[model samples]
Target: MSEAASIAEMPPRYDPNGVEERWYLKWEQDGRFKPDLESEAEPFVITIPPPNVTGELHLGHALTYGIEDILGRYTRMRGFNTLILPGTDHAGIATQNVVEKQLAKEGVSRYDLGREAFVERAWLWKEKYAENIRQQFRALGCAFDWSRERFTMDPQYVDAVLEFFIRLFEEGKIYRGWRVINWCPRCQSAISDIEVDDREREDSLYYLRYPLKDGSGDIVVATVRPETILGDVAVAVNPRDDRFRDLVGKTAILPLLGRELSIVADEMVDTEFGTGAVKITPAHDFADFEVAERHHLDMPIAIGPDARITEVGGPYEGQTVSEARVSVLRDLGAGGYL
Candidate 1:
């Protein structure tokens, strides 16, 4: 029998421990993983979804790399010039938080280290964690071109990002404005919606009475967050709701702040929910922020980035959200507004 036929008929014995590394190293040394750009062969190119340089790889990384490696190897065997590029992401806030925790261990903050020193420290942290990820990829037998490895924070990448942003700004595609954003108090940065994790949690709902300015009567508005009452700028109700139809053009007195709040009719209010009335605290709540913008209402920020009540919170200023909730509820109950 031919040698190839004999090898094909051999018993199947899976032993990756010694075999994988040896074959992978040989493949690298033989330059089989490198693709010739000028070649006429069908090209199969893939760039890894760069893993964060903030930490070591986990089970998720293993699974992802395994699937991609299978594709790369399959394409190479099919006579395609496969090029799999490997890279690591700076992960911005994630990497910053990791370095910040390290700094905290030594009783120092990033601000204390200064910008230049902090950047230097962050790069060192990236280098350390990046190598760990590279090894994990190799263990998974990923046939990536290590010579083409890249980092999101590299000088070329940084320049490209800057150019993109500058082009957008010049074209009027980018502009700064006061907008509601998902903020992380710990990271002290704004994060995108996808970064937020949604989970079920038990919470308290508070109902407060807002007295009408014309002495007609009071409207009860229910809220899960009473601490935000300090930022109340308007009281909204569905225009189609008969209960609040007559009070649309009137004004209401904000319970705690004693500020005059217009009783506005906005379609955004759900007539079937919570007494059909909602207090609009534009700066704190996203829905309220949109309603306030539509009606041209003022936005008062009662909470700061630290999750503490701000100066606009009146007597509750400087108190954390939880603490202020207790104080606000206590005062509301005493004043017969609860």
Candidate 2:
């Protein structure tokens, strides 16, 4: 309708669509793509990297599957019993996110539907999109065995997955442990490191005045994220820096939260950076988390999964990150610690 050239008709002074319609579909339907199991021809098998049933296939899918299709065609022509096995992955988080967004538009959430009902909606979503994806594979005129197409959540595939996990468990290969992870506040889920997108932005650095428990004049440290001060376990200075060398063993009181923060000297601290000292909020910042581990200090969480200030933040508890930042700065300014 938009006058975009159909891929089938995209060729030099000729139409591949006619050839494709008369041959590719019949060649595929006649089982020309499927390798003969009984034949002694040298087997050339390649299992597809399953695509998620999220939506229509994109250019990424075209690039990958196109290469495989070429290889499959070449092998079959060379008298090899080529088997290009095709399948779809559940792609768990991505699929759930799609369904949740749909439910959101209807003024409901997965919680309202409950686990069983939510899963039902997910299946319905999968069934709809998975069929479209399968059809797209055929529309591309690839020599794939549609009859043998599999879904990751199919009973047989599920059984195979469970068996593999059970074997790993029996060998004591999997265990639970405390560690830092990337959490999506919007999704309320933990995602892999690959899912996080890093961005560069300019920000103002705030100089926070931390009071000494001994009633001595305050020591100042600089930070870009003043909100995480509620979780501060320690303040670190460069061990080689002469400025705060004497104050290394002293205790500094966190301004708003009143948490006792030990002043520690570490080589990781950048002496040339702001104020030659940095606050260590282990639960909120990765660098601070590492510093805490080296000092054998407790890692108290300042924020919850919803990116809201937790109970440990005291007066700022339940406030969103932005809201808490304003409140924390306001209180800090009132107390003359900003």
Report the Cα RMSD per candidate.
Answer: 4.1, 6.0
Candidate 2 lDDT, tens digit per residue, 170-262? 999986655678999877888877567889999989999999999987889999898989888999999899989889899999997788999
Q: Give the alpha carbon lDDT tens digit for every residue of 1-338 in model 1.
A: 99999999876998787789888899888887899888899999999999999899999988898899899989999999999999999888878988999999999998999999999999999989999998888888889999898898789878989999999999999998789989998778998786788899898778899999989899899999998899999999998899988889899999878999998999999998789999999998889999999999999789999999999988889999999999999999999999
Full-model lDDT for every candidate:
0.91, 0.88
Which residue pairs show collisions in model 2?
Answer: none
Which stretches in model 2 have alpha-carbon errors above 4 Å?
Answer: 1-13, 29-32, 35-45, 72-82, 100-118, 169-173, 192-201, 213-218, 239-250, 265-268
Name the best candidate (by TM-score): 1
Model 1's lDDT to the true fold? 0.91
TM-score of 2: 0.78
**What TM-score do all the candidates reach, one by one?**
0.82, 0.78
